[model samples]
Target: MQIQLNTDNNITGSPELLSRIQKVIDHELRHHAASITRVEAHINDTNSAKKGEQDKRCMLEARIAGMKPLSVEHRADTVSLAVSGAASQLARLVDTTLGKANGSEKGGVSIRHLSQNEQEE
Candidate 1:
């Protein structure tokens, strides 16, 4: 899957951060990589230097073939935490989406017809 990262000014949005986020997403969702076309992650600081905690927000959108886009959001005290939390959510979302699209429920058996020779055995 191709991962695209975005962040507001309040967040550092460094290349290292983006790389780390991408790696997390890739590792978490590796099984669904083929079906997924792209992933867009938006990170921001809701409080923007405010004194209160849990201000960072992370929104992730994953696009899969023959299915509606799947999204997940998480809030944390820092951008890294938000990213990690969101990535985990996105992983589960992709897993369920792929399962449904494959006409299976969480890796359930897919019944199929067998050829005449094979069926005889």
Candidate 2:
């Protein structure tokens, strides 16, 4: 994945940045894989369990694998989605913080108690 940083704003990109991103992606992938593995293993472990869920899971896995599934693509997509969500959350936090700071300076809300509020438009 071509990760771009705003180099003009002193946001220089480096190999270390790429490595860190890779690591984060890897960790997220591991979590996803672990969950799927756990589910499949649980189904297998419970020999006398309901066959419906197991069959569904197996079918799901089969369909996914049939789509030329590589664990890497799944991992990358998962990581990208997670990072996007986190960035969105962080942006909201920053906007709220700045807004509250401005408000407090004008004798509105108290800066000391600026916990997460409702999402602003």
Candidate 3:
């Protein structure tokens, strides 16, 4: 999937940082890569120059084929932590959203179908 990184004025979008973020996202969402068309990561420091707990914020938006885009955000003390957290959240969200859309859970029978079978039985 295509990955893009964005940073606010306070934060520098360095090559190393971008690469690290990309790796984290790729690793987290590898299983859903085919369904994902693109991912955009927006990171910024909420406190700017000041130091604070959970000052760094990362927002990840993923575009899935034939579905509306999914987004998740996280905050942490460090950029890496924020990115990782956001990526993890996005992964779970994508799994659930896609699973429902496909009318199956982890490649198994659909819950709705199961309920219908039970009623008939």
Each prediction's whole-model lDDT (CA): 0.86, 0.30, 0.92
Please name the candidate that would achieve the greatest TM-score relative to the true structure: 3
Candidate 3 backbone collisions, by pair: none
Candidate 1 vs 2: which has more lDDT: 1
Q: Global CA lDDT of candidate 3, please?
A: 0.92
Candidate 2 segments whose C-alpha is farther than 4 A from its true place = 1-77, 104-121
User: Please, what's the RMSD in Å of model 2?
Assistant: 19.3
Best by lDDT: 3
Q: How would you encode candidate 2's per-residue C-alpha lDDT over 1-121 as one tens digit per residue?
A: 2222211222234666445544543343342332222111001112233333222110011102212322111111232343433333333343344445467543356545544563331
lDDT of 3 by residue, 79-120 (tens): 999999999999999998887887766645654645676957
Best-to-worst order by lDDT is 3, 1, 2
lDDT of model 3 at residue 33? 93
The estimated TM-scores of all candidates read 0.84, 0.26, 0.88
Worst 10 residues of 2 by lDDT: 54-63
Give the lowest summed-lDDT range of ten residues in model 1: 107-116
